[model samples]
Target: MSRLVDAHCHLDFSVFAADRAGVFERAREAGVESFLVPGTTRARWPDVVAMGAREDVAVCLGLHPCFMDAHDDLGDIAALSEWLDRHPEVVAIGECGLDARFADSWHAQWSLLEAQLRLARARRLPLVLHCVHANDVLARRLRQLAPPAGGLIHGFAGSPEQAMAFYRLGFVLGLGGATTYPRAQRLRRTVAALPDDGYVLETDSPDMPLAGHQGERNEPARVAEVCRIVAELREQTESRVAADSTATACRLFALD
Candidate 1:
């Protein structure tokens, strides 16, 4: 397969602490040449930044919507702006987006998300969105906000129409372990239907384990598996999927 990129992964998470070096080594052995790691909170921004120091890794800093409690009294939005100013090497602004599952913080989620969207626009940086059950709302917001840098909707699991909606907004979808399962009929169809530049492959490591690997810690090396499944769904060769997805990710993030 052509060189691959993990468009989104939390390789900074403590779960990988003991063998993080091996993780990178294994990913490189699997042909994954780059990783985009997004920070989920202010607390981990430093670690995420440190991880980005690696030549093969890029990073994003933002307050994840699910972790509202972490941002609550910390002025994290302003801090995120400052962090971006200080870390010009940072590639994007997220792991941030609306998730309807946290009902109590629904309104707060919108508030924080809008702030980050504005930051992305002002900084002229792409985003790494983490949306769940809020695609319609997010699409509308993106239309209104119009972050020129455009971004990736990481771990996308929606209909073809939804994927097209994001593509129209200058954002590309990130296909991960979710598409490996037979149960994800709609997602697999979306994978087959996407335009040549409409999506990138991801692993969302230590989280969205691929089908048959449930309960195991996902890793960037598995992004090759994602490419294999995407190729099968699109009826293209794995090399083709790897090349197309890596190109899309490089373009979106301005990666070298």
Candidate 2:
């Protein structure tokens, strides 16, 4: 419990707005040192950028697949360029990827994903990706584009082979609350067996709560619990898991 990073969390989301400072305080008390807040649409990038002013937090901006209809115009990509120019300290390009659950908007998702991939390449920043039942397409796209900064496939709960598919293409899987569920035996085993460098920890907060907190709002503090569960699953000390995953996120986001 020395030091840890919540590699992905939406701290700017409405759930934490009333007590965001308290959330950070609680997380730091639990050994969570830094939190990466990813933007899900152009509209929220400003709020995320505002949060980036805090030394302990990092930010990434992109249009999320589930919010496909919200991206009003193609110029949002241009707006993204403007945001990056104005906020060069931003860590990565993401929370972007395909969601098979939204297959009807697959074409729009592809267009946004492609543009963001290119933007991440141009910005020389890593990506925070989200894919649901779309690994093959995501893998193919990553292989084709080969982003130089690489990326993290956020909230990965797939098989080890599937995780390796992303690793082979210069991406890493993100392990989170998903590992804390007893029924997630396959995912837990996948997380345990992967090479230490192949993944980072996350919470995707206010969304994917851990097993016991099914109805409560997830805070970055809970990531410390995630670290413990990951350590248990991997049969390593929590300190080891904390250090390794922190290092992985630091490298990916170019955090000093």
Candidate 3:
């Protein structure tokens, strides 16, 4: 079996509430040996941390931009910094970034993102960004900060030119089920053009399901299907994509 990793997921979400254990077991059987769960809220940080304690799970802590309305206090950023200081299991700082698509207040979103970026830099940990239709703003901020340690752009659907900008800023493009859809022409093209060394594989489970399973909830086990599609697009074998992506993820998170 080709060893693989699901670089980003939200196992704490209620989608896996009934049989989370079974979901993980099925993922392992599919050759997804490790999973990274990123926290999106202060209250969920403990649950996220607990999930990471499981044999093959790793965790990242940060407030997601979608929940900007929820983070009224910037103190949560400090709390996360303290948490990172104490917890060795916490691998990175994010699932946080600017999302101008759904929210009305870009200032609040940018504030939260900038604070988290500072925390990640101070802690010397990588970031797990969640950018949505704001890659230009994201790229600009990343350039200004130039964090010594880099991170991954989860669920990237930008153009090849935009992707190259991120690559120049030392970020990895996280590819997932979005590229599997025949209708996602631009995304497919971007994924096809990405360099093997500049990408990582993810499922973003309970969210971006593969083409055939579009309406169904996604699971970590389906990452292999994603790899197969990516490999086909890149004109490479599944084993090669799986091995290279897993290595890229390991290096990003400093996994042993």
lDDT of every model, 2 decimals:
0.93, 0.89, 0.89
Candidate 3 regions exceeding 4 Å error are: none
TM-scores across all candidates? 0.98, 0.97, 0.97
Q: Which one wins on lDDT?
A: 1
Candidate 3 on 5-91: residue-level lDDT in tens? 999989989879999989989998899999999999998998999897787889999998888767754689778878887788898
Give a tens-digit lDDT track for model 1, residues 142-178. 9998999999998899999999999999999999999
Which run of 10 residues does model 2 get worst, by summed lDDT?
Answer: 68-77
Which has the higher lDDT value, candidate number 1 or candidate number 2? Answer: 1
Whole-structure CA lDDT of model 2: 0.89
lDDT (0-100) at residue 56 of candidate 1?
93
Candidate 2: tens digits of C-alpha lDDT, residues 1-256: 5588899999988888899889999998999999899999888988999999999999999889999888954798899889889888888998899998987999899898899999998878899999999988788888888899899999998888888889988888888888999999889889888889888888999889999999989888898899999999899999999999999998889886
**Range of the 10 consecutive residues with the lowest summed lDDT in candidate 3:** 68-77
Residue 54 deviation, candidate 3, in Å? 1.4
Model 1 steric clash pairs: none
